[model samples]
Target chain A: MIEVRHLVKKYGNHTAVSDLSFDIDGGQVYGFLGPNGAGKSTTMNIITGCLAATSGEVRIGGYDIFEQPEKAKKLVGYLPEHPPLYLDMTAEEYLKFVAEAKGVKRSDMKRQIEYVIEVTRLQEMYKRQTKFLSKGYRQRVGVAQALLGEPELIILDEPTVGLDPRQIIEIRDLIKQLGKTHTVVLSSHILSEIRSVCTSAIIIAKGKMIANDTLENLENIYSGDSYVTLRVKASEIEIRRALAPMDAVMGVECTQLQDGVTEAKIDIDSDFRDKVPEQLFYAFASIDRPILHLAEEHATLEDVFLELTSQADISEESADDTEAKDGETV
Target chain B: MTAIFKRELSSYFKGFTGYVYIAFVLFFIGTYSATLNVRGTYPSFEYAIGNMSFIYIIVIPILTMRVFADEKRQKTDQLLYALPVSMGQVVVGKMLAVAVVMVVPAIVSCIYPPILGKFGSVNYASAYGSIIAFFFMGVALASIGVFLSTLTDSQAMSAGMCFLVLLVNYFQTTLVGFLPTSALASFLAITVVILILAVIVWYMTKNLLAAAIFAVVIGGANFIYYSVRPVKYGGLFPDIIGKLSMFSRFDTFIESAFDLTAILYYLTVTALFMFFTVQSLEKRRWS
Candidate 1:
């Protein structure tokens, strides 16, 4: 539903977003994952036509945002970094104003607003002025604003920011529900939020697209290697000897547990990740060293996110003094 | 555009700004009408509007200072930019809302001449003509105030700068008297004005090359023209500077027959400033 190509946004001497490109199809929750100042908000703003990119093109539902902003924006519902609420206006009044601005027909305005208010579950707070709302309610109002006009694409920039834990969970669940009918693109630094709610993710760092894939695929691909821990009925030297002939085993460390039982941690080549345990069982059986207990470990999304962002940070700061980082670490 | 207009209009009325502005205009105009038209037995109602035009300099800043400034301060302009509406729509919508607020006093002032005619004769043609001119003049001032609001996010700063600019515009005719009328003096004065214009362009765009080019083109043209026609420079610079004054044009309507030129001038000023407002907003997204 959205296509961004070679987008760049520069704020004078500082480059906020640079060379970022990604495509999002409809009917799924796509996580826009990035660390702070990673240009997530900038990219979202450009996509929603809130800001102009330095150079590049953004298309929404086959419409160029710059050339046909009115038609293009009609297909989008955007909740920016801060909820654009009039402090003096009641939530109902603000929603009505938004409904009218989005050109929702007068006949459908009430019904459309009611539907969004129901979807965002803002039934009770509709009459209250926005300034009186708590942070979570304010965010819900922002989300409700985006949900108006039945726009097929919803771009939310850090929707769960400044919300409490329970509110975050509610918003994530709300996003999951929204994903059933519309293409929901939400940017957040919270990995668990993306993992629990999003079907796919686009991870970016330093204004560049770094990774984009399904959650399962990303975990499997970037998890790198699988390590097997086993308790074997043999001496350490005997167990090591038995595993030494296997080409799949990259490295092995063995320790004597009790009497004749030995514990061994075997790092397997990623190419053999699938059959390492089964092959090891047969190999140990051939040497009469029975494999008693075994388990494999895989990396989590947190590890992947940290690894990607920190790597980008290092490369981004390479032109600066690396020695300066030492003091920060200290 | 209608959505924005309604919201802006409702905001003005919901808060005290609209009421306060109306009260200020009516209070001063009321005092002037009582003193000049009632007690002094003056036949012309336009004289009262003419004498009290200074209220616009103060009330305009209050009315328009928050129109765009508060949108920026609260970051609601993001909603405007993201909405299906164009920047032109937003600018025109808010301008029209301010015009509507300005119309309140104009409509109230209309009752004066009719009431004055009850006691004696009144020229309804010129009297009503002045009211129309007064409304357009308020709209023109409001447009300038709205444009000034786009320059900053702080309401206080917007109000301050608008007040300062309009205050200077109000006194520009009198201020012209203090300027030197000699050929060399006009030449140097115009050069300084061009330099200031270049500085403003630099501040807005932050492009030294663009500003430098503008300075050279305008300043160089001024030097060339002044050196070529030194004999024609007598008192010309002050008159040119006085041309920037908006309030003085309203005096033409009060002094003689209905001045269509003054109305056109007000409209042109309104259009010019509104265009600047739209461009300023578009520039913000790029820079």
Candidate 2:
């Protein structure tokens, strides 16, 4: 439903979004996962035709956003990071304006507005001025505005930033419901929100795409490297000595927790991660050290997000190194 | 476009801007019409409109300051940009809305000439002609104000800048008379104006090389023209400034010449500034 190719957006000397490319299919809730200043908003802006890419092509529903903006924009609804609400206007009036601006038929405008208001649960606040609405209600108004015209795709940028936990969940559930019928793309810095609500995730950092996959695939791919934390009734040296001879143990660090208890963090090789727990069990048994705690720590999406974004920085640094080397050669 | 026009128009009436602007303009119209036409027994209604032309310097700013600036400040410009409408449509719709708000007072003032005719002989042609000219000039000034509003996000800044621009245009003719009218003075003045234009270009495009090249080329060309024909530069600055003054063009109608060129000039300016406003909005997407 959406294709962003070689998109680059630069503000003077600083590139906000760099040569990023992605394709999103219809009817899936896609999460744009990135840290702050990671160009997620810039990419979203470009996709929704709210911004111009320095040099790139964006297409929505087979229509070029720049060349056929009206047609392309008709197929997409966008709620920017800041909910674009006129404080003086009532929610109903704002939605009416959006509906008209979207070219909703006069006959269907009322029904469409009411449907979105109902879905976003903004029926009661419909008569209130947007300024009087709280941040969460204002956000719902923004969402309702996007939901007008029944666009095929909805793009939201950090939709739940300031909302309380319950409001966030409501918005997420609303987005999930939207995903059943429409293509949804939401950008967020909060990992848990994306993991809970999004089916597919695209991770970007430093204006580059670091990872893109289904949530399950990303978890499975990142779950290969696991850590095992152990609390044993032995001295630090004995705990270390027990695991030192094991080749499957990539690295281990032990700390003395008390007179006879020691806490150890063991990094197991991917090939032996499943069996390493059993291996540690026998190793500690042979050493006459009683095992108090032994649990495998699986890598969650949060860990994957951190690893990928940080890896982006390391790769960027290496790229800088190569450029410096070339400069030195010249 | 109609949706935006209606929304903007209703907002003007709902808020203080529309009522205040209409009252302000009509108050002056009433005061001027009473003094110039009714009290002074002047037969011509154009004189009142001509006298009241200065109100635009204050009223246009108030009417147009929040049109685009408030949208940007509130971040509602994103909705406008993301909407299915083109920036041109949005801009024209807004300009039309302000024009409609301005027309309310113009329509009220339209009742003045025939009423003034009750007391004495009134040249209805010149009277209505100047009213038309006043409306055109006000719309033209409103367009310029809208363009200025797009240059900033703060309503205060937009209003201040708009007032400054209209004030300069309001007194442009008088300011030109202060110039020495010498070829050297004209050359220096034109260069300064070109430099300012170039700076604006740089500020918008953020391209230093382009601004420098533009400044040098325009400056060099102006110097070449001056050096080639020094006599042509004599009083040239003042003439250009006088022609550019929006208020000065209204005087021709008041003087009883229904100048088609002045009406065309107002329309051309209106179109030009509305086009610039659209470009300014589009440019933000790139920036």
Candidate 3:
């Protein structure tokens, strides 16, 4: 377990992280979701002891990070935004050196190194110098280094960046596998990546955590009213008149459709599907109109993410970002 | 500590810096030995060591510049910081590694006195004494270089700044004579020195109030001392500066005095700078 209480990191006049606190339990993968410069890396650095916190304490497996750093650090492994690697040394040699520095026993060292190499699939590149390796392989070596000593907690910062789609899937699978045995905490700006891998997520905008919950719970929390999309072989006025008469219906509006069939969206509270669909069916039948399509449009995770993160003063710098995400969510 | 020490030592030989540093030091040693001991027919190797002591001002920077600076520039210090080792252990390990690199060539230099004994009578005791003193003196100088390397991440800048400091320490005795040693002049000099120290303290702690209090206290104490005993300040500043010269202290061992005070001074410098190196590293994490 890792507990970060009121963590803060400041650089001169700029605040990197402010009054952030969260607890991470074991055996689950947690995602840190934020845009660029959102203090994800800073918080990870502080938790892993790479950077000192301005105020507050981090306890890893009940060991205070500042007071008993070696004990606390022994329980955690960290990979920063850039893999801290020695280009001059081969991957095998670097892993051995790190294993020794991490206080792995000489007897277990060989076995530990082999395990990480196999897990990261670096068996082919073990003898090659890190400088000659591709960026993806270098990142794998970085992950391999963190896996050494078998720390209880592994923290990765943007682990899938700069990788091809196939490599990204491979790493995502690896992270999911690691989560079954060890707690995994990863940060990325990719929403789908988090949705695919993370059991829970914490989303931050401008250094403040805006949401922290499961994807399903977050979708429900932001979803205020239910809307349904219905397609009927009827005129727009006919469909609107049928939906507007239902007692549970708040309003109805006709939206564009590709087929000759007309489409209208119905807004209502609770699950009025049973009564409303029957009422609409009878009303439309009496008017001799055929129903082609009827389905409830459930809110997606992207909708909740946009509605929450876009409320702050997004600058001209991020206007394009908003537009791009808006297109996908809509 | 052992892991870091082994890595540092291996890195020295992995690059040309270690071999070049040893070759440069030995080259100067060979030239100085021929001129002072062989051609001059001096029985004591101490004379040769004394004449060649200035070589450290150049070689020490080359040997120690990349020790911490390269780690920082490459961002490998993050690995060190994240490791389960204390900052003190890392500093001590690197210092010991550099000491090994320096002592290796000095060991080869150790065989010179016995070989010279074949041609003529040689003072073996004094030769060994000076060799030991030379080793400690170089260690002390290298510690200063290591501390300077911790202050910046640019290797060239670290080397340049370390070389400048060594130059000042080498010529401090001569430079001291140029300073006026009158009561008022000594008072002003001490005040300026104390204020500079306070500023450095402030830079380290970033506590302006504490630094201001310390400066006032030191300035007030010095002023009271000068007012009470005006004549005692005469020639004191120059005498103090001469005492602080790192190489000047080694002169006693070369003269065959076996001065334990100089040896103590060298050890003190080594300890003080090692402590400062640790502090510099710790401060980097906080800031």
Candidate 4:
């Protein structure tokens, strides 16, 4: 479990993470979704005790990260954005060093290292120098490092950035496996990855939390009035007249596709979206026009991400405009 | 801490830096041993160690340049900060690792004393005393190098800055003699030194107001002291510089007495620089 309250990180005059707050429960894969420069990495760094927040309180496993860093850090395994590998050291040696640093008992160190190597599937390349390993292998080694000591919380920052598609899937499966036992938090700009892997998602933009909920709930909540696109073998005016009396159809825009074919994009009211498809077919049949195509377009997680981030951008611009006006008045 | 210490020690031996440091120091020791003890027919091993003290200016930078700078450049410091260890432990662990590497050559040089004993009466008291002092002095300089390494992510910059710092410390005794020992001269020199300290503070913290306040307070205090008792200001600058020179303290061990104060001074310098190194690392998180 982790609790971050009003966390803020600033570099001189520029704020990286500003007044951010979030709570993560144990044993679930939580996706940290944000665009570039959205303070995801900064928040991860502060939670892992790798950075000092300007003013905030971060508690991991009931331990304050700043006050009881050693005790708190013992419950965390962090893999930074770059993997943080010692190029000269072998994977086994690096893992052993990490195991010792994480306070793994001498008796269990070998078994624990092997367990992580097995989990990350880095058994064969464990003896190879990390510099000789490819980026995907290096990322696996980084994950193996974080999996050591069996920390209750595993925090990774963009664990599959440069990996190929297969490697990304392997890492996703590994993270899903990790989620079964530990609380896994990973940040990525790719929305589909989050939708596929994470059970819960937190969306942030401009260093602020915009949305936090289960994946299904987020998609449903952001999925407003649905719409249907219909291709009718009728003229634009005739298609419009045919649907003009229908109360279920909220609005319709008819575009002439060819000489005799017309494409009508129908916006259905939320209450009638389901029955409108059947009603649409009968309405065209009665009008003596053939229905060429009928398809429903529902909102996806990608749309949710774009909408939230763009909404944040619009609000930020308005805020800047107000501040500029205030400055002129002063 | 042990994990870091072991890795640091292993890296030194695994790479060329540790071997280069050992060979460089031993080269000086071997040269001085042949010329001073064997060829010159000298009875003191302390003289050989004393003559070879200047080797630290070169050897320490090589040993310590990569300790923190490479970690930073390669972004491995994130691992260090995220680990279940304190910054103090990391710094002290690294300092001890460098100290172990430096002690290897000194320990090997110990064989020379007993070798000289077979032919002539080597004063084992001063010989071994200076050897111990020499080891402590190397650790003291290595601590400065560690602190210098933490200031930058470039290994070349760290090494160059450390070399320049030690060079200044090496010639500080002679440099002090060039200053005028008058009250006005000492007052002006002390003001200049305070201003330099302020500038260094500004460079590190980037707080111009704090640095300005520091300079004004220290400079004002020095001027008041000079006006109140001009005689007290005479020779003050040179005396302070001479006392601060780490190499000058070793002379007492070589020439006359095994000064416990000099040993204490070396230890204090080591502690002071080690503390600075820890603070520097901790500062990175805040900045």
| Better DockQ candidate (2, 4) | 4
DockQ preference between candidates 1 and 3, better one: 1
Give the TM-scores of the predictions, in the order they appear. 0.88, 0.88, 0.89, 0.91
The Cα error of candidate 2 at residue B173, in Å, is 1.6
Candidate 4 per-residue C-alpha lDDT over A42-139 given as tens digits, one digit per residue, 9 for 90 to 100: 99999999999999899999999999999999999999999999988999999999999888999999889989988999978999999999999999
Number of clashes in model 1?
0
Chain B TM per candidate, please? 0.92, 0.91, 0.95, 0.92
lDDT of 4 by residue, B71-93 (tens): 99999999999999999999988
The best candidate in terms of TM-score: 4
Candidate 3 per-residue lDDT over residues A1-330, each given as its tens digit: 988788888999888887887888888899998888988888888888878889988999999999999999999888887888988889998999999999999999999999999999999999999999988898899999999999999999999998999989988998998889899999999989998999888887777677877777887778766777778887787777766667878778886676657888888765564566677778788888888877876576677778877864365348769899999999
True contacts kept of 1: 0.93
Candidate 1 colliding pairs: none
Q: How far does residue B216 in candidate 2 sit from its true spot (Å)?
A: 9.2
Q: Chain B, model 3, TM-score against the native? A: 0.95
Worst 10 residues of 4 chain A by lDDT: A268-277
Model 3, backbone clash pairs (residues 3+ apart or across chains), number: 0
**Model 1, stretches more than 4 Å misplaced?**
A227-296, A317-330, B191-229
